[model samples]
Target: MNQERSTLPSIWSAAPPGGIDRSAFTGKKPNKIIPVPHEYRRQTLSRERDMLIHDVEQKTGCDLVPHWDQGKVTSFDIYGSGHGVEKATVYLNHWISNAHTKSIGASAWAKLPAYDPNKWYYAQVEELDNVYKQRFRGPVPSEGDADAPRHAAVVDWPEDIKNTSQEFVSPREVFGNKLERLDELRMQDKVYITLQQSNHDGHWYLEILGHDVVDVELAREHLTTMIQTVRADAAGVQDAHNTILDEREGMEVELQQCEPWWPNQADYVVPQLLSHAMMDKPGSFRQEGLHFKQHLSLQRSIKAALDDVRRRKGAYDFVVRLGCLALSSKTVSKGIIGRTVSKDSFSKQIHESVQLDVKKWLANNEIGCRILHRLMAVKGFLEPTKSGGYFGYTPETLKETRPIFRGTWVFKDPNSSVVATQTSYRHPGRPAPFQKPVEDAQAAPMSLFVIQIDWTDDEQGMYEKGTPTFYKLPPGATGPKKNMDISLLELGESRAWHFALESLIPVPRKTVSPVLVGFAERVRMKRNYDISSTESFAEWDTTLNIKKYLQTGRLDSIYSFGIEKTCYKVELTAMWYPSQQLPVWGLAVRHLEWASHLAELEDLPIGRQAMWLDTISSFLPDDGQSSSNIDEDSDDCGTRRLKVDDSDDESPRDGIRILTDKLMKLSEIVSSVTDCGGVQI
Candidate 1:
């Protein structure tokens, strides 16, 4: 594959000055020179150099130029000169000392600006040795010199002391009493120093700054203390909360054991129980005033206990009823399977469901059963239900119906081919060949099946109850009118309960082959599946749709078969025709061969894949063109082969070979995936 190369812009911000050449910097023999006036050039060059030196001094805070006065020298002999040569030479020595100090200071700032005075300075052996030689023995020899010292050091010096020497001296020694002004810059980690040059008149000094290191130890200590205090407080609060919860639980247990007493019951039962106890006391005790007082105190205590029980029981009952109602409403809302129901009817159903659930719960609960038993003794008490048990469909219903759908109703036969084609006969008068009979012809392989149900406008009012009122078959006069009518069938109470339960419970989904999953994924990704205006593409999943139809036996619409080709495409759809039914769902099966090949092409670049598709399509017949030609003289029992015209330009064998290679490659891919824990697409 040939790929196009992209040219990128150069990284340099700007090109070098146009007129300058490499030879100018190297000081080599020039190929060409442009002449200019000597005085003009001299003044311009001098000013530029002066500006450069001034800029460097300002930025570095160091004086590079020497300040000295020199008289005319009459002779080349330096020692015999009598024109204040000694004073000028003294100034020259001061300048050299200042230069050395500046050089060391600049190097220190560049390499270790934030050096900690507490930690002794350390450097490479050769580097320290070179610095030592430069400071004591003068400048070292140039690199070009054969006798240059590469790693020279004092033989008498200790190796440890040489590597860990103090690079910067105390400013107090250099500044004397004047160091007090620079004290603010001095810190435990760093200190300021001055580069100075001394003459007979005064001293020239350049103040060098130091790096500051902020101390965060105190702040860190405060934060740690604060965090510990917060955690301790949280633990204390949690402990108190747990103690309260334990006490509350003990109180609730005591309340559950007591019979709930309502205000109406207190009006009659409380007085009666107290009166009975007082009358049952001994005649002698009843005559004494002290015994009477004791009886009254006992009566008051019993009344307070009953009141407490009533309050707790009332609140508990309210919360339980509210929670059960909410739960039942949510269940009813989500139970919608095929159609929607009306608000009034849906609410009624929710209330009924809640009533049933609450009744069942009360009958089974220990406290609730006790309350009901006590209520049964009351004169006007009427039971909520005669049976006092759940009357709706339960798990037993599901168990009994399990055998009805059992046996070999649906089977998986991997060897069975889904596609079927009719054989053409050459003779018009010849009868079809005899076919072998099978014991069970009704049996069909476990393939995808879709069924669509339609409801009319007259049944629209029935949706308010969450189910259609009536169903009508398509226009056909096959059976008697009475037999064809669904309303004619007498549905028993158990059958109605079974139907309701089945509608509420979702159908069990079946798992599909990975190959089908991969194909569905590709179709979804390509958005190649057909859809109606009422349907949303987002809700469409090929795998999920097929599973739903296989499980629920309900389909919304019938899909177009799409353009026909030589490759097999299988589909089975059943739809009902009604005037006002909702839109039907359908499935569109593309050419199996093309679908499998396209899955493999996913690894290829989009552009290349499209090109390959176009190339292969060119070899295949168009939709308008016949896929295969049949010979009329061919025998019905004999194999029916596609008869290709020799006069055609391209041979059919080439196309077949290409398709076969793709299928073989697909098989290899599937085998490899299966060997290593196959992933579902």
Candidate 2:
């Protein structure tokens, strides 16, 4: 076999540049091929792969086979033969028997086998060394004096280094005078010779035919040059071809040791030195023309993917932050400090802040960093106490307290940062301080607590003469061999409560519905979106447009106060109680009653603006007028006319009923929440 095609040596030292004529090397060759048997199979084809082949052949224009198995290939396979050929005989004859051993074949049969040049072939010339001997008989001369480095055209070294050692002999001495002498040693096509220095980096080491070489200048240069060429050739890049050919033929390695806790160590690195060095030449990494260009493209593809993820995360967080802001403070002041309010004014304030902050953040980072920037925008909204954003935790409860949620508000109080007024019902013995008791779990000495006139009704004389009756907790209990007496009020006094205006309100019970459960699950699966914050005005408003529709239904009247459609054009007149009070009152009821607190307090904690639902059913008028006068479904909205009556210098009976009805509605709403397991009146 020809040595060039035989054992496949590395770094072929061909006959000195022009030492032999080409006519002697060319000869008569066979046009037909005879498949060699049992010496080339590396591994058998998988059944699944064969099935895939059958399917592809039926669907596509061509048949396919596994080109390579592991690292070896079946070089003698004879496919695409005449129909008369025995399929079994052809398959068995071509099967490799011992991939590890060399096979003997006649030299006459050694001529270059016929093949489709368009396809690739693992061609090997048999007995290549013997053929070289027969064709070029004599001692092959060196291309230059012993002083010259082997194949000076392919390598360059410091003159001093080249002359310093005998290993740096010329290519002529290494191969010989006959062209066949060089041809005999040539290995498989496209072989590389890597040289390295061993001791004190002065000794040379060679891996004549293997995968890697030691770290040295010669080896580094050769591998680096080859890598550049392969990368360019494989990618079909052409501009830097000449530049790559001129590189030195030696390797240089800087030993990068992996060390513990060392900043400069190679550990955890992606190992790109070889790739980087190879691509250092200009135009070597480009995809001017080639197959699989997209596969090798790393920068643009990975960056775009990252940017997409960031944008999604950013948009989600932006919505969530908007919710918190929408539920915060009011932009416009109403008739009185605590009397009337333009519906959803406070919530609108929060929503504006969320939108503004997110917009600002997104402006700076643009597309790729969108997700991260949006998250930061949300943090900015709550971290700064613009309108007292609720991260979903109660303001004054341990369960509602979180490092991130605990916020501060500006207040005009000498003793504290913020101060709120409150009213409480107490027994005759308890002092005025009972309105703001400091003791925990200590109940006032009162059997029954009556609400103030403002909280009750004059029409029915309710609470004017006798205390309005409601359910009460009976004290005392027994367990095992002991007797216990635990009162509901005793437990209630210790719980956290929220002050809705000046009235002391109870918290609502937490009820879990399938919808709520699904919402909670969605919240949990996300990396952000805390459950407690979802109930806030900002979150609710930003999350959906339905909330604004809900608010419209609860308004009695919306007067266009500003110039036509200009700023401040919409002025809403509404009479509604605080929605945030429910959670405060609910938690209190649950803990005081000694019932299991099944809910997370953060989920119901209201910020400055409570989450609200404005339904038409909640705003029906109380006047005794006939319904035939107006279309009940004209706009599916509710409105109540506020009527004032003076008779004998006293308010009218109907007037009293209106106020009572308002209170009852509040009670009914509370009751509805309690049905979810909150509390009873």
Instruction: For each of the candidates, give the backbone clash count.
Output: 6, 57
Best by lDDT: 1
Tell me the deviation in Å of residue 674 in model 2. Answer: 35
Measured against the true structure, the TM-scores of the candidates, in listed sequence, are 0.12, 0.12
Q: Write the per-residue lDDT of candidate 1 for residues 361-437, one digit (tens) a residue.
A: 11112222232233233232111220101111112211111000000011121112222221323355656522222
At residue 679, give the lDDT of candidate 2. Answer: 24
Global local distance difference test of model 1:
0.23
Off by over 4 Å in 1: 1-566, 570-589, 610-681
Sum up the clashes in candidate 2.
57
lDDT of each: 0.23, 0.22
